[model samples]
Target: MEGDGPGGTGPVHVPFGYIVASEKWRGSQLAQGMQGKIKLVFEDDLTSDFYLSNRSCILYVTEADLVAGNGYRKRLVRIRNSSNLQGIVVVEKTQMSEQYFPALQKFTVLDLGMVLLPVTSQMEASCLIVQLVQEQSKEPSKNPFLKKKRALLPLESCLLRTVQQIPGVGKVKAPLLLQKFPSIQQLSNASIPELAQVVGQAVAQQIHTFFTWSG
Candidate 1:
């Protein structure tokens, strides 16, 4: 959206990430200020039809909304893994971060790359939006050659390494073990019955022996 510039000499068009404002933040000062500063497209629901096609970073007004057990959170996590959209959650400074740290950790573990912004209140949120716009504007174009320079993770090796770290699970069984338990945390905590269900009697006994080995 074009608007009169600060001095009113020309139109100011600030490129912005798609802003999906929640109903709770409607009529707030932050929302009002954002209208003038960026090219905002408002939505009543955080997970709307727009986000499915638009790959813009989401602007959440509160941490609770971002972490809530809802379809919105599910879709956000799905897109983060498959797309380039950044999930930025804005929380008030007055709120304790510890309360939301677990949720943040979950996002990190899922590779969602969710960002947290702790502001004093809604007013500071506007300042953050301005800063984001300025920084985005200054970003240099990417070099096509740099794509080859980026290091790629060896998934098979990494998965084997993690599974093998568990007792009784080695190279031969690590791949099958992972098929049953996708993550190290899950493999480490699986009960004998659960392990046996996937890897059978003898292997389950070996796994149980490894985790229970007290020596």
Candidate 2:
């Protein structure tokens, strides 16, 4: 991370909810549009257009870069290979740059596995950058990229819980009943007399009647 203090140029932490933009971005239209929308700290040492966070970097490819061809790709490849950080390539895709955008998209996204975001102009890229930074600033669990918590698994505790739901089976008796039967199939097939050995005659009858009850 780069320093945010006025002209200090020293290494510093990137505060949450702020952007560390490249010094080259100063005076650009993108920088102008970003004013008040997101807090930016410019640094000359930055390798990309902006560092959304320590884990993510942004590369801006303007209409001029598309006209230049293949050169921007080399820059992208270098950044992708050299850094472990997530790369987001923001490409300007207005009418003039439309033709070149497809090929550029293939190279950056399909080939490199880096994220590609299309914007009509620098202003749109600025807005998208703000959204990206906002997403990064929030708790990781709430981030869109993090997978939603997995569906509940059928764990042993879950099995014991299901067993305890049987009428007359409390927590203690649930495990004891499962110890002999091992599975629902084996437990259900057990006669009341067979189940009596573990849970005693009364609960044995209740357990047997619970699974076998048709009404």
Best by TM-score: 2
Error of 1 at 4 (Å): 28
Clashes in model 1: which pairs? none
The local lDDT score (0 to 100) that residue 60 gets in candidate 1 is 46
Tens digit of per-residue lDDT, candidate 2, span 29-104: 8988889988888777666777766546677899989977878887688667753345567889989998887788
Q: Candidate 1 regions off by >4 Å?
A: 1-24, 44-54, 59-72, 82-84, 109-111, 139-215
Alpha-carbon local distance difference test for all models: 0.48, 0.67
Task: Tell me the lDDT of candidate 1.
Answer: 0.48
Candidate 1: residue 202 lDDT (0-100)? 83
The per-prediction tally of clashing pairs is 0, 0
* Candidate 1 weakest lDDT stretch, 10 residues: 145-154
